[model samples]
Target: MEADEKIEKISSQTLISNSPSKRIRIRPLTKASLVLRGTLVVLVLLTAYTFYTIDVKDVNFVQGMIGTAKNVKVMFLEPHLSHFSFSHALYQVMITLGLAFLTTVFGAIIAVFLSLFAAQNLSSKRVSVVIKGFAAFIRAVPTVLWVLIFAVAAGLGSVAAVIGMTFHSISYLIKAYSESFEELDKGVIEALQASGASWWQIVFQAVIPSSISYMISWTFMRFEINFAVAVAMGAAAGAGGIGFDMFMASSFYYDIREIGAVTYFILVIAILLEVLATQIKKRLKVNI
Candidate 1:
């Protein structure tokens, strides 16, 4: 009874004390948020205006939609290769896979070293900032644009594709790897330093081992991205792969069935790559 009376008296006193205080106020939107909202509003208005002013030339919407449905049906349901044999398609797929693999391997190798400078814990602030800034610039450029840029020097072929893809991959993996390295416990690094361990020794013994799993995960993810990019490069840069076949089928032959077949092949390979990555992670006891 005493405890309950005490609680009631304290609650009443708190309420009475709080009664004269200002009510809790909600925060106003920040400048960044207001800017974002304004940008969105502008984009919406522009989109609406563009659509309102757009002209359609001699096309019936219902007929167009029906034709699209038919094309989709033919592409997906009745998919079969017309010009190329299954073996040829498979070989082209292997070429694309090779490009992806080569770029990934090269990028991983280079990024591992570059990331040492990019990681704040491992490098000085100026070095990290410079490296990260360069990487950001590289990443800002589209992979296709890079390929085209390099194509001027390397000429239109696998060489340009590989160089461009690897360049982008290196930038991407550097960011990923540096972030992973930064996630390392500071105590462990400090302990290594106190033990009179050399920088190289500490990196090899502690850093690499601790972050190997993350490195593997990022590498595989980049490989997957490179694979998709390689496909586009095949057509765009004349790199010559299944993507070229896909382009030819779609544009020149207008063979939806062939396009569909190539699509299925790519899809199957993607699934297999995912499964392989999962298995490797499991084998290595990598949780991530």
Candidate 2:
């Protein structure tokens, strides 16, 4: 019988009287799901209330938008030279890029060694669990917060920025790398073990070869994240960069025009990096 005809039987059965043989089986809603739905409803209500409270004060949305549109000429058409010079903006942007590169490279290096112990397939379950817990703690903290914490010890600058960003980056890489290692061919590992291959030899010849592509892909993804953090740190942590220029323009509303130029530069650089990463990943896959 067709599925459409099948629904008629159930519907007709529901309309008829219940019996021991024909009793409808109703699944009760789980308490967890019920609570989840209730919580979501409460959150939505709170959000709506907050929006109404704030929106009342800014009722002239159209007028505000028109005013902002007029400012676009000063903000985007002609931008103020950041720090009153082109060289300064160039130098700062380079520093931000360098900071991000250093953090990602250092983080990936540290993670490579740590991931061996963190992978349950390679290491004891107890060891992997413990290592993962530590990484989880670090991952739970925001990258910007880590930068600020390290800034207290390292002092505010690129040094603190690199150290903080690398700290979070290591945990990020560890989670990505260990997961990739865990997915390595189980049969290959078993065969290597049967042949009495040492751990180091198996890792280099088997595990590494099998998972290098995933590791590289994860590293590139993390690099992009670190670059964004570096830009934020440039302004927040006094680690001079184009981000600082942008921050300055925002803080001093008179120089809002310069912000447009700084924003455009950042947008271009980000787009270029994304395209470069995609090309590199494609080439890496082809080579593999």
Candidate 3:
């Protein structure tokens, strides 16, 4: 009788503890979730405050929209270069390409040597850490800022642009190249070591050959980035390219047609570069 009574009591206790009402309650929210919610709330409050405080009493919304439409029509429908010829624009584009190419080549050469020391599998832990940390710091700063800094010494021109772009590219490529190198198979490295091969021999025989495809891909990607940066540097650093001509048209002359013409040129060139890169990679069968 006592055992039966105890069993009934335990069964009743379990039923109370595991009630449907208790199961319906939510699990505890995590710290990340709480912070995300808080950030959203803060942003919403700030946006509301900004909208409340701004003065738009004198604004003419309809006129502004009509003016914008007219400007767009003028730009796209009628685009012609009044100040510069087509050949000049093409030459300027070539200059920009040259800048990008030079920077990629120089940076890749330097990065290859530096990354050999930065790869953890191939180099000492201390050296790898130092190289990676330094590269990170260099990459933290904007490429434009680096160009301006070099401009202080080299003056604002192609020289400053090339040096600054190359500086940033080296840091970027170091991290990329080192990571690729580190991904090499440990078994291959060990076998080479056991066979009495020197470090350079092992690198040439196994590492470079294995990672060449990836390296080429990374280098080309960097080239594309450098080309865009060079265009911007042309206007900002006085590097003199199609970008400079566009800046002159838009800012000095206030010519929408000229701006549109420059935009078309840049767009066409960019498309050609993409096609070229794709074809080259396909021909070489470079995956990844």
Candidate 4:
């Protein structure tokens, strides 16, 4: 009788504990919530309307791709295989690589310096605001405009493309580097300062080391962006890179074969850069 009473008491307690409350309440949406929902619905409707009017099927994408493939086959099997020397194509590739290297290196150096001024924790309030504004101004201007400016000032060739890429890349690099620096542990900086380290020493020892992985990742990402810019400006400025060749072929209504070849070359370079960046991230143990 005692054991049964104890079991019944435990079961009753469990049932009581699990029971839901009898109270009921209703919550109404705020004005802000209703406005946000209405805005989102309007935006979705606009997006759908825009998409519907685009006529994406008019070009027959599959047919165009088949045509491109045919051109590739002809270019590879005929004139490219028989008449053209590999050395010519190799030279264009080298030019693109050189341009990319120069712009990325120069831009990264400039960005490192600018980042010091732009970082909120590193610079005075006035300096930080000024630097941020300047960076924003640089970013607001399109690369095409920069290319035009440099082309007129520097007078064409790879020089213009290099300058254009470097100018635009500085803005991107500064923003990325500043953000990375900001993400560093504040406690580490505080400890270093407490130990009587100078600003430079603290930054070099505590901040940079902690943020090196992000720095490298940003640099690689900027390189890819600058490479594309280089290609575009190279063609526009008559810089004799692969882009120049591609543009020339298009201007003369030359066989799509030539255009396809140049495009393939660019695609291959982009793929290689992506693979190399991935490997670097792995080696550095940088988690994105």
Candidate 5:
């Protein structure tokens, strides 16, 4: 009788425990949710105020659109091949390509070293912090300011553009490369270290080979940014490039067709880089 009574008591407790009303209730909105909602409201109001204060109505939107369309049409109708001969447009393209290439290469090389110092796991905390701070400082300054500084220091030319792009490239490359390094499989490094491999050997034999795809992706992305910056720097520094040509064309209100042509060329270059980089990433992914 006592055993039957205990069994009945256990059965009743289980039924009650399994009931829906006995389950713990969770609140819909958390503290984080409320904070995010408040932040979004503030951002929306700020954006509205900013738009209201900016005299966008004073701008000739319709005329500008018509002018741009006409210029684009003229560019397509005109012989870009002929313009390549005397206009130095081709030379400017070459200069921009050369500067971007050199800056990316040199900056990537320097970035590899800097990234080692900046990586928290790879270096002392103080060294990593210092390197990160330096990278941030470099990134904080505008590329245009760097161009002007170098232009005055180097006496106005492609050289200044090259230096400015290189500085900016270092900041980007270091951050990207270090993050890539951090994401690497730590097990491989640990295994290599366990087998009596030196730090340099482990890095070269394991880390770099594994991170090649990410490095390539980042480098190509930086190449696109560097190319755009190089063109802008060329214009600012009065260096010979499409940017300079475009600036001159704009200043004199010359054939808008020429300006359009330069813009088109830049677009083509950017598209090409993006396509090529995509292909590279695919190939790397497949190979891996």
Candidate 6:
């Protein structure tokens, strides 16, 4: 009888404890939620309508690929020394690499200063807002367009490509760096201030030290982007690089093998960069 009573008491207590808390309550949607849903629905409809209007009557999947089978085979099977000499391809690849490196370094140098002022935690709200707004304006324009605009003054070539890529890189880095710096512990900031640390001292000792890893990581990511842009600008802005060779093969003739070789080189370089950045991040143990 004692055992039966104890078991019954435990079961009754469990049931009572769970009764109120275990019930699932549906979230009530407010006007803001309704507006957001309505906006999403409209955007989806617009996207569907746009795709529906495209002309696809001439498209044939098998027929299109069948025509390029030999070229494809040569490209995939024979990646090198098919169309261009090895030395020439190497030169172009080096140019692309150098361009990316230079742009990344230059942009990162400028972005560090800009980010110092852009961060809300470090600067006045008005100044941060203004700086951010300016960066947004610059970023809103496409990379190619920026290059083209600079081309008018700098003339078309590697110079234009470098300037354009750097402009976008700075804007990108500033945003990333500011956000990382902003994430520094507020309590740490308060302690530093209480210890009579000046603004510059706080930033140099606290912010930069804490966020340097993230800064490096963001810069590496931007380098990858700038590299890709350099390739495209080489073709578009007459900036001589591997992209120029690829562009010629694709635009001028049916040089399938050359296209394949250049594409392979680019693919390898991109993969290597990604691997390097990943390794650095892992080694540094970057929190951001």
Best by lDDT: 1
Per-candidate TM-scores read: 0.86, 0.85, 0.91, 0.74, 0.75, 0.79
Model 1: which residue pairs collide? none
The lDDT of model 5 is: 0.82
> What ordering of candidates by lDDT runs from best to worst?
1, 3, 6, 2, 5, 4
Candidate 6 lDDT tens digits, 235-261 = 999999998999888888667777888
The regions of model 5 sitting more than 4 angstroms off are 1-87
What lDDT does each candidate get?
Answer: 0.94, 0.88, 0.93, 0.81, 0.82, 0.90
Write one digit per residue (lDDT tens) for candidate 4, span 1-288: 999999999999877777775333375678998999999999999999998887776688799899878876876655341223467766887787778888899999999988977888877889988988888898999986887789888888777877887888898899999888888877888898899999999878877888889899999998888778777866787766767767776676575666666777888899999999999999899453
Candidate 3 colliding pairs: none
* Stronger candidate by TM-score (1 vs 4): 1
Across residues 34-151, which tens digit of lDDT does each residue of candidate 2 receive? 9999999999999999888775575588998888898887788886674557777777778888888999999999999999899989999999999999999999999999999999
Order by TM-score, highest first: 3, 1, 2, 6, 5, 4
User: lDDT per residue, candidate 3, 102-186, as tens digits?
Assistant: 9999999999999999999999999999999999999999999999999999999989999999999999999999999999999
| Residue ranges of candidate 1 with Cα displaced over 4 Å | 1-41, 286-288
TM-score, predicted candidate 5 vs. hidden true structure? 0.75
C-alpha positional error of residue 63 in candidate 4 after TM-score superposition, expressed in Å: 10
**Alpha carbon lDDT of residue 131, candidate 2?**
92
lDDT of prediction 4: 0.81
TM-score head-to-head 1 vs 2, winner: 1
Clashes of each: 0, 0, 0, 0, 0, 0
Error of 1 at 183 (Å): 0.8
